[model samples]
Target chain A: MATIADVARLAGVSKSTVSRALSRPEMLLPETVATVQDAAEKLGYVANSAARFLAGGRTGVIALVVPTLDNSFFAPIIGGAQARADAEGRQVTVAVHSFAAGESLTTFGRLARQVDGFIIVAPGGSDDIVRAAATKPAVLVDREIEGMSSAVADTASAFTLVVEHFARTGRRRLVYVGGPGNSWQDAQRTAAVRAAAERVGVSLEVVGPFPPTFAAGAEAARQVRELRPDAVIPYATALGLGIQHVYLVAGETPPVVSSERAIVEALGLAGVPAIDVDGRVLGDVAARLLSQRIQDPSGDPNRVRLSVPVTWGA
Target chain B: MATIADVARLAGVSKSTVSRALSRPEMLLPETVATVQDAAEKLGYVANSAARFLAGGRTGVIALVVPTLDNSFFAPIIGGAQARADAEGRQVTVAVHSFAAGESLTTFGRLARQVDGFIIVAPGGSDDIVRAAATKPAVLVDREIEGMSSAVADTASAFTLVVEHFARTGRRRLVYVGGPGNSWQDAQRTAAVRAAAERVGVSLEVVGPFPPTFAAGAEAARQVRELRPDAVIPYATALGLGIQHVYLVAGETPPVVSSERAIVEALGLAGVPAIDVDGRVLGDVAARLLSQRIQDPSGDPNRVRLSVPVTWGA
Candidate 1:
């Protein structure tokens, strides 16, 4: 491959002159521009992007790692990152740990070299593993490792919204279906559900830590029938489907509190009331945070939380 | 960048000796391997991946390109691809196209060069564009363009199954909520729904090539009320949520048909029978096809379709 020196030698000019000819073509004579272009092409030289990018705002790609794409909860956040990346002309490369089978850690470790930064969603790695990953510019989504920058929604507020919604709907014995025990979102959601119900003077049963899937949702629904909670609020959309299905079958009204805007839109058609979180905005926040880390790798990692509620067709 | 010749000159060996030392090290003399390794490190000569890939069987990364990861329909396919790639000691770099932002073509065009090979969800571009993408070994998912190899699901068969399921429930009037109109899957699905409904002597209304969102599904439901269809069969899980919600609010049952396994699970919890096509299976087939292409680019491109009826809940 052609180096700047090769192009310079071929063009009968200094390396700085060749660089000026390519990057600041307007400042150079037209003849110099032609000579540099020709020589560069002849040597099959493509300018090193990272070296050139050092002086610019930024446009190198970032790797956004998600547990799975199936969950409605994660898609908007991922989408937000892509939109933001595109705006800066930095491409987003998606790497799903869910698909990596058993070699996710190794796979992710390898990706550390390729991306300028990362957006890790509830990375299922340990503290040491996470620390190793943070050597590269990265932002955690819905998770806060001990030392990484993070952007997350306030689950306690999200839970409070659910409890309040249920109380207004005249549901006293409400149930909450939580996500897998390991998920930070699920843990926070679980805490919020328990505490919110107590504060609201409502009887609540926490039925999960279930795997986030439609099957798990169906299983949670069977549990809901047994518990007979006045309404069921699954912590997120993946489980919400099954929870809602059980109530629909029982000819009952079950309200949901979720970050799934898509689900909210779906439920709106059926006149199913819900407390919606603007996941896209969360995604946007997450993107901004990731960009910050990529721009300055030495900064102290910050944790930020924000939320918005959408009560549509209520 | 250090070339093979540069490493050879530094190592006091020929280029052929350096190539053998780096790629087929086991076949080289111990002294030769040590000299080459030392020389490579001294000169900062990491083998160019593209050239090394041609010389060997592995690049340790697999690339996938899809129209959008935000669409739940592709989740299982991506998951399967990721899992398989992970098992094979490969990591995935996915590029998602945002139609809303007019970004797929540009994003994909840029992504194709950075990875070892690509797994394209749709042969989305014009013939010239498709041919350009085809230059890199790739396997298409669920779509078969004129000159590309693909792994397609029997969408026609699946559509027929949905119609059959609807008819079995003694429901005559039906509505088919279509997928993205620009997608080949959508065209095939619409045709199947029409042909199958005609064969079964049933009246069916077709709505949308909409954005494949819950809002689109809900809107279709609103239209369904006007059309007085007995059932609403949507093309995707997000859409299924919409149509199902509309019917639920009306205190009615409109059996849903979708390829979304999540929706099917939700419906099963509600006892709303659904027809599901296994997306994971579709993904697996696509992965194998892409791997085959990468392994033998000079071979004729083969297009294969895999279809299986989903028995609802399971």
Candidate 2:
């Protein structure tokens, strides 16, 4: 609860001197900075980020915007991002855009003035809107806009792994279940799976752009069964679990390849294979990159792509 | 983007009049309130809740505190609550308490100042801490504490239905797999099941205070099989799915009772019966109750309990 004025009075320095030492220490004298820091430490001055934002520009708070909090897809990412931010004395406020067009832009417009930066996860808005909204330091996770820093999973390699497994298992035809059409990850995944299937000389049938739920997956499963694909590739774990359930109910053994280990685990998919994308690691990396960008907003955007490996359960 | 000054000028009123019209309309003259409201709507004065908090006591934002966001148990609840809050033009900020001792109290301390009210879901804190934290307008969801408004699921009736199903099916011994020890719902469900089992003249074996994940369920399944319970009752869908998987892997046929429809649907527990607790409905009701509390902080606390019904899937 100690304020900057309290630290300044304790250090025998002006309020501006203490502010300069904290924000631009390199420009201040070392002795002055050291004295200010010592005084701040003695007073246990945890600078109120919101109050600082009123005088200075940055509030040590960052925002992580996701489509929705209902799925486990964003849970680890959110946990990782918040943990990393908290370690650095920053707080993360999560806002759900709910895959609505222009929702991200609207949320960003409201939050940008308060938070120092943003880490938008799989934004549903158009690239133009995203670019316009991110006036502050911003990092996009699992998607890439033209002018934003991003951390994306290696979808190409993930699909290649799944397709190779299908080929090895003599599954010539595969049905690909997808998520929302506006989803950047879903589009990338579908394109990658299509390219991979062509490379492996297997027929790939793309089913949907569903809401990424078990019910939607079950509904898609009926379509998949009618089409009779030799194997299945679901873009998300939720969809995969749904398809798996429909198959289980019909007492049919259908081969499936999922994109997340969490779904495989949740469905008790032993002997079933999935690509481990590690959303937490992606979230951590994105937070680190965003923090760096917030410190220096002039550089070219940094793009990080984490690799996804196939994991099999016993 | 229209400020209070703009609305006041347009309405031919003072800034304080505009503020009073929005915060406490009852204090203003009816004609003056209508004039201010019309001017505010014309200028599109969507008050920034954070800035409003600094000027006025209430911030149009509410907090939804959950133990963790990872499990599907709270997903629908969160979604429904947010949806309802959004319809009322209130923003809900979610904070994870992680179910650790003192975690809920710490979160309440941090969030209590900025939010107008709180909707705490399945609070893991002790009764004293929970009661102390309700100094502000608050609603406890899925848990009950003395001197606090609450919306709890009828776990006693839910367990009675499950036990009756077991007794009718000729399953004498039922193993109950539980969630975290700190979980309020877990304790209630376990105690209810124990009482119901005695009434039904059936033997009940208690297994866990696990993390309520598939791995925990699988690990508990080993212990469950060793005990050779006639049927399994997992407190959560994730644990139920895990137990179902272990049974499938061992090719063992055991009747299982689950507590969530979403889980049953996700895991395709068609033949397996489950109690449909409808978390979305619970969330909506809790949000409504909390909103009411925020409006009238001095009212006698409202307590609601929704019933859970057992459904046999085909």
Candidate 3:
């Protein structure tokens, strides 16, 4: 087999010099590195990745964990994570907890030390795995896990943004379409919405804490009809897409992905007059937060909370 | 700060035994391994990822390269990759080529040594990257680069499945929607549809070779309306989603996401009586192919082509 030795002989350099040029080219003189490369290319020699890696501790890996993705709110979150990792020149392995506590614990137990760090989207595990993250450079987003640094939109402020959007538009019967009851996020948003209602003097009908899914979003539309709210506000884009599908099929305003529980998505389309909080922003923010914790595990980490104000489409 | 020595002493084993228990763990006795783990857990001692990686070799990272996820077609393929990686206890990093050939080559260069291996989806790069992948343990799925071991589906067969469905539905006038003018997959599917049209004696129209996008699909709707075919088949799921959207909002039965545009994904979601094919199966096939080649690089390599029939879904 033509190996680095062959390239070293051909390029008139010592074997150790060839190894340095091949593995740590930056440590070599430019002409020596170039000559070795030219000889290697001629001989069709490629480095043995495993051997090179064993000599250096660069695994080049990061992991992102999401509890479940059957619900699409995590879609943008996933998208955002991918983009941020791309920017950092790192690759991410994503793990879904399946919303089952036992499965996540087992998944992370095997996974904790494999990657450089983890970006956990709503960890679902027994107390064992949950505690494991505290020892690592872990960061939480959207869902809160104790003893971890988190970057979450302050839902209290977010609900205020949604409610004020309704009032400014002169819509009095503002309805809050809640997410699944089991989610802590649902409770947080619902409470924020109710508090906003008191401040704004609007009849805020808290329609749910329903399943945070498109199918459930369609069902919420049925409730919307019965309540007859002047405006409907669903928490995330995935739920919004479903409710929009119901409204569009029923010949309602702002035609896009939702009518038949999400018909607009069927077309190569973007939402019209959509409220995009930009999950990429959320992801970039989380990456910075997580990287900081990884760099200094002992520091009292800062939590960043943000909410983009909403506005109606023209 | 508690090191492997502490765990080894607690577990009544050598430090080397403790190291072996965590890295290449298959080498250790189960009971001894358990003792070391219990002691480590009790001490709240996390393995320093850097120190342990010296013996473990690579970072356990897998890189997945895709065209772009702006299309629904790419989303499921990514989902398939994620599922397979999770099952095998690996993390995946994704990179997208934004239709810029030179830029993609640069991305591959930056990514080459960083990842353990690559799984490229419809590669868009210079011949150098393709040459690199050929010698390295990289797998190709969906599209083939000349030298790499690839997993591919019979576009002809996938098209046959879609055409047969249209025929059975009594849709006489059929049209094929293609991706942007230069897309290889679109041309392949378009040709297949043409062949099917001649065989079935059905009137077929070729409406596009437009950029495969939702907006592009919506724009194609104007062309389809002029031709007025009873059945529309785009190259893959990307355009199908678009056609379905335009039809739903505009009140027409434009097409499905798999209307030949991205059929593998189209059948999975929205199920609009399209052909369903699994990308995960293709990924596994690709992995096995690459592994065999990596085992012996000089062994005369032959192009492997496999086709799995797709089921028409409602």
Estimate, for each residue in A1-314, the C-alpha lDDT of model 2 and write its tens digit.
Answer: 68989989999999988777665565677788778877876875532444445345465567788777777778878778976775564667676665456342433444564568889885476787677767789999999877689999887677778877887778898888878888888888888889889988999899887887766776788888887887888877657756765666566665655546654665456756677778788889999999999989998899999998887654
TM-score (all chains, Cα) for each model: 0.74, 0.76, 0.72
Highest DockQ model number:
1
Interface RMSD of each: 6.0, 5.8, 7.0
lDDT of 2 by residue, B1-314 (tens): 57889989999999988767665555667788778877876885533444455455465667787777677678778777876775565666676664455452433444564567888875476777666766579898999877788888886687778877888878898888887887888888888889889998999999888887755766677788888887788877767655655665565665565546655664455655677777788889999999899889999999999987878665
Per-residue alpha-carbon lDDT of candidate 1 for residues A1-314, written as tens digits (9 for 90 to 100): 35789889988999988767654555677777778877876775542333234224332557888877767567677678876765554556676764222342434543553457888885355555566655478888777777788887776676677677777777888887877766677777778878888887999888877887655776778777788766777766657765665567667775543435555554443333455665667777778888888777899888987774645343
- Can you rank all candidates by DockQ, best first? 1, 2, 3
What DockQ does each listed candidate score?
A: 0.27, 0.23, 0.21
On TM-score, the leading prediction is: 2
- Of the two candidates 2 and 3, the one with more favorable DockQ, higher being better, is 2
lDDT of 3 by residue, A203-229 (tens): 878777666544566666777767766
Cα misplacement distance, residue B289 of candidate 1 (Å): 3.6
lDDT of 2 at A145: 76
Q: Given candidate 1, what's the lDDT at residue A240?
A: 72
The interface RMSD value for candidate 3 stands at: 7.0
Q: What is the lDDT of residue B54 in candidate 1?
A: 30
Ordered list by lDDT, greatest first: 2, 1, 3
